[model samples]
Target: MRKQLTVITALVISFASVHAQDATIEKIREQGLTQSKVMEYAFRLTDANDSRLTNSPGYFRAANWAKNELTKLGLVNAALEPWGDFGKGWDLKKSYIAMTTPYYRPLIGFPKTWTKGTGGLKNAEIIVIKAADSAALEAYKGKLKGKIIMLHRTDTLKPTYKPDAERWSDEDLSKMAAAKMDTSRRRGGPSRNVVGSMPITTRIRKLAEAEGAIAQLS
Candidate 1:
């Protein structure tokens, strides 16, 4: 009789717990159905503000907007805290590049971050620099000034054989999740003999800047 009473008590407790959970879920569902602001929040985050590059004006605008919105919703002490000095912010207003002489054809390219703009619509000569090593950079010392330079040779475009987009299979995801840390790469860091002390591109850019090259097409 005692065992039967204990079983009955357990069932009663279980039923009460389940009923409480159901009530909580129903309240949440009702709130979502009637008071959902999903689209509003999405538009405000994306289309309402400019792109949010770190430490940029657009980033701050979105952040402040978010803070204000949260405060309106009764969040306590909603504020943005200062993160220490991040370098100056930059934004692209407009970019245009084309070949006019050979035949007026628009070239597809964007300026690199922190690169100085070519003021107004100006036509400049393009020079291709093919420096194999630091020693090879000496030949173009005085010639690069007032010119747009291509750091590397033009690549030949090839036809694509495979689909441009692909979705990962369950097996691929499982393998990725199971992947272990590559300790061998981390053990010795990087070898100096295999790689140069300073990158070739950096050296090239420094030289170009020092010599007053108008722009770089990379």
Candidate 2:
């Protein structure tokens, strides 16, 4: 009698598990096929502000919009809690940069954040520099005065036939899961064994300013 009771209990548990799995699958199908509102919410959030930097006015507007949206969805206590003060905000009114001399081309570039803008349309010569360190920078000491500096070599672009977006196949996912992590020490730690000086990106920017370069392009 006890053995029969144990078998019966096992059967009941298995049945309950199957029922729960079916319910979960049904919920996923309902949400994926019919009841999802992802795009609607995304459009509302993005359209509320042009730019949403943390300290900008547009950010506050977007925050309020999100709070209101949550409140409309019957969420309780939707509020923007104030964190500590961030730095000052900035708005870009008008920006235009183009290559006029040697070839008339519309240059694609974005100004660095928190930097002063070029006063209206001003033209300057492009000075290409391939300096990787302070020692290499000595060659262009007086040459960068009143010029736009190109600090890095341009990469060649190639056309591809593949689609822009794709879902990972089962094989691709399995390969990613099986990939090994690199446990080796990085080269630039605080130890004496590390080779090479500090990074040249910031140092190059400072050198450009000191040398009177109008702008530095990466």
Candidate 3:
């Protein structure tokens, strides 16, 4: 009788294990393991299928389409809200520049994003300047009024045709990656602000204007 009881206990344990496995699978399915189906449609609607450009008809169409679609998707009170005017927009049709000094090198540069448009026909001698603030700009203030100023520090690109890792082994790469970086680089610290800060930059720009410095090349 004891042996029979042991056999019955073993059968009960085996059935419990089988029941647990089945429950786990049911839970996974109920949790919507394939709910990634929503993401497929979502990406198509919000990104891939939408054609938009700020202030353009395509942009407007996408905006309204999104609002209407959300409303249809059981969004209780979907509405297209009017916000502040974001001003006008323009696209760069074409632009070109070349260096005529130091060497006849065709220097390559692109303006910053979201900057005021130059109407594809504006051309002037580029004046480079780097001022930390208003005062530093004063040194050449009067001069920069009509000049094409480069406000940032100019960097000459060196020819590094090969990848840096090509010159080092795996151990060297690890050592370089693990090396401590410090602030004493470039031979100067905060004192390197030759032009000064923003307010100082404005002051310097005003001074430059007074001194007849054409638009500065920062």
Candidate 4:
């Protein structure tokens, strides 16, 4: 039993190592364009589709669209892998955001992919909560049980304002390397708004019984 377990563990680790080596992530990183491709894909997917609907005929259209693009890019065996059963479906056809009051302005955001639609209701009041500490958090206990929680930390927005490119001298580069890089990127700050979907059972499919809100805006 011990020898068999050791063999199994070795095989598992070997398979993991191979998987890591063959990852598309590693190839993209090697090309030094992970950030650029992300933006390009984001624009192509979200902006091109205007997707913020559910069972969106557009969503399935976009899926087929992606399948075509993936095959074009030489991803062998690229195809839609459908999961067993979602008796009904949903998808986004369009999304719009603006501050209608307190001065009209555009709210900068991209909807979380596959989020449910606004169901013909074009506008809704946005409830913002600062989920910071015990007291501030408690202030929102029952209230925020269903409201959108917008965390106010700008940790992930790094100081990306490099005005000009230059080759630093060895001494300058060495000194820069001595200082630690920023750690803010390690903080997983954004919340996944997973409550857009209405729940399902064999007999009934009810609206999202959110722990309290219609949707999480963030």
Number of the candidate with higher TM-score, 1 or 4? 1
Each candidate's lDDT (Cα)? 0.85, 0.80, 0.63, 0.60
Clashing pairs in 2: none
Kindly report the root-mean-square deviation of model 1 from the true structure over all alpha carbons: 4.1
Q: Which has the higher lDDT value, candidate number 1 or candidate number 4?
A: 1
Residue-wise lDDT of candidate 1 within 93-140, one digit each (tens)? 999989998789999998877677778876889888888687988788
What is the overall TM-score of model 4 with all chains considered together?
0.37
Q: Please state the error at residue 63 of candidate 3 in Å.
A: 2.6
| lDDT string, candidate 2, 1-218, tens digits | 99999999999999999999999999999997898888876776677476787777777878898999899989999999988987788767777778786778887877766677767777888888887787887787788778888866556889999999999999999999999999998776565422343466667777789878788776
Q: Write the per-residue lDDT of candidate 4 for residues 1-218, one digit (tens) a residue.
A: 99999999999999999999889678877776544576677676777776635456666666777888899988998888877766565644566777777789987766676556656545455656544334454454455443444544345856776767877899998898898877676756444432221121200111123344456554
Off by over 4 Å in 3: 1-33, 37-62, 71-77, 83-114, 132-135, 152-196, 200-218
How far does residue 122 in candidate 1 sit from its true spot (Å)?
A: 3.1
Candidate 3 lDDT, tens digit per residue, 117-138? 4555444566666666545555
- Ranked by TM-score from best down, the candidates are 1, 2, 3, 4
Judged by lDDT, which candidate is best? 1
Error of 2 at 199 (Å): 3.3
Worst 10 residues of 1 by lDDT: 185-194
